[model samples]
Target: MDFDKLRESCRKISMPPEMKSRIKTNCKAANADEKQRSRTDGRLVAVCVCCILLLLGIGLTYSGIFERKLPAASDRADASKAENENKFAEILSTAKLTADRIFETTRANIDETEMSSKTQTQSQQSTESTVPEQTTEFVTNPFVFPNGEHAANTGSDDLSYVRPLYLEMSNRENLIIAKEAAETMSQEDFDLFLAENQSMLQGGYFHSMNAGEYLEFTQREWYIPVAPEDMAEICWMYYEPTHEKIDLGMDFSETSKIRFDINETYKADYYYKDSNKYRYEKTIQRDNATIKIYSRRWLYRFENFAWKGYRMDITVCGQEMSAITTEMPLEELEKYLEMIDFVTIKDWLS
Candidate 1:
């Protein structure tokens, strides 16, 4: 047969469907095998070449061309082998490109996922940092009356008598009371008294009196005395009529008396005797009682020099007496004493 006729005859000689399917399956299996498997590229190429030669040999023999055109058949088989090798190379190149594209796409997806996760974590941390911290306040009243009740509410008004009393007792007038009391006692008795109350003497302040003494003053008929229950109210009315109440718990007994004393001496040069310029005095005349108030600017040498301060003394004739000292001005001091109602002995007697 001629070359063209022989080639056409080879093409017409078809393999069985089973054989074709088996060849496709083997190729796919080889490609899909583990990288470490014994199957290599060189081995796969040799197998393909052998399969092509076998098919050509079978076709030439079946067509009766093997014996008559042996050399020509050999040449055609070599050409078919070269063509198969080229097709296999092309398939391998296409597969490699597809694998590289898949790897790039997968890497990009992984990177994006990781970046998104990091950003979310940072955002949560920032939110936590911006959040504010939480705080607390404590308020207390320290004045208590002899009856175990709070002195904060004892007065008619909201002001407590403790602050004013404390201020007044801290003055040089305390020394005057001490001197007057000293005059009544003999030197020996005075020394004994000082020895007995050494703690209070050294403390630069007077010891508190008992409930009996406090009651004695309050029960007096000559002047109006503030009842323990009304002490806070009265003091409040006198001072800070419009201000809020601040009850600083002062240590005192219900029957505690109003006493004053000082450890150091005060000179006359320190006294501001100008009653009008340095003092605020007022008289509140009631139907049956007259309330007299005298608040004066007093100076004491607490440190190196004289420090100006105020003292308030209240007297209800034939009724009662109350006094306080403070570093506040006369105007402010007046607020603390104005609300007190002085009742005379005649009024109480009636």
Candidate 2:
């Protein structure tokens, strides 16, 4: 049949209304029944899964698969002990800090007390020091000092403690007097003597080790290098009152122009402004002895007078000696030092 004819034939083919309704009702009821059956099956599967999981969990529990080993009693005790020790250490640390603080406080108090005591002692000492000590008079050189008091001769060192006591007792005006007194010498005679007898003279100050002129105070007046009672260079001062040359080191002094102690062991230096005015220092080995040479370009004070020059120091025969003079040339000074009888003096010392 043709498509148009076939389509007309299909349109004529209609179902009964009751039969179509019955078919639709049957389809809806079947869909509802299928949905109900699906819901019941899902509920049954869920219940079966829950029962299987519960049984599996119980079986695992009975087989001991999830069991853990219990810690030993000793381990538990150790843990408890460690905790107690930690707490005890913490308490001890706190106590230590408290003790440290107490110690520091006590130490500070002790320091304050010591400081107070020291201050009181110092104050008392200062007050006592302000008061003058009693001074005795000089019997021999009474007229020399203003207060008729002179320093006691402590040793063989020249002017040991003399200049300081003079300075202490004397005023500035007396410094000028000191300068004048120091310079009261026959310069012409000194020059002539240095020129002539310098090489001949030895043994510090004595001319020939001959003891002369028995003076009071167990001192013999021997050959003096320079003259006129007030002047001194190398001097032989002390001797037995018997005019006996019993020992070589009766008393000897070596004075020079520049300021330095012989060995600088004694405070005999005429004070100078500074050591900063130094020129140079030198060392020389001569006659089995070390000679130290110190030269300064600045002035040195002899009482109030200022002088400057070269200084040479040497220790020989257990005696400190030096020569510092512009009065004589270096060559002459060296010769003068060389001529000193240190070898014989060493024997005397022995």
TM-score of 2: 0.19
Can you tell me which runs of candidate 2 are displaced by over 4 Å? Answer: 68-350
Cand. 1 Cα-lDDT: 0.36
**Which ten-residue region of model 2 has the weakest summed lDDT?**
134-143
lDDT, candidate 2, equals 0.36
Model 1 RMSD in angstroms: 46.0
Clashing pairs in model 2, backbone N/Cα/C closer than 3 A: none
Q: Write model 2 residue lDDT over 56-133, tens digit each, in one string.
A: 999999987887765786896576555545543553454455335433543554455445544544565677643222
For model 2 the local lDDT of residue 163 reads 19
Model 2 alpha-carbon miss at residue 320, Å: 94
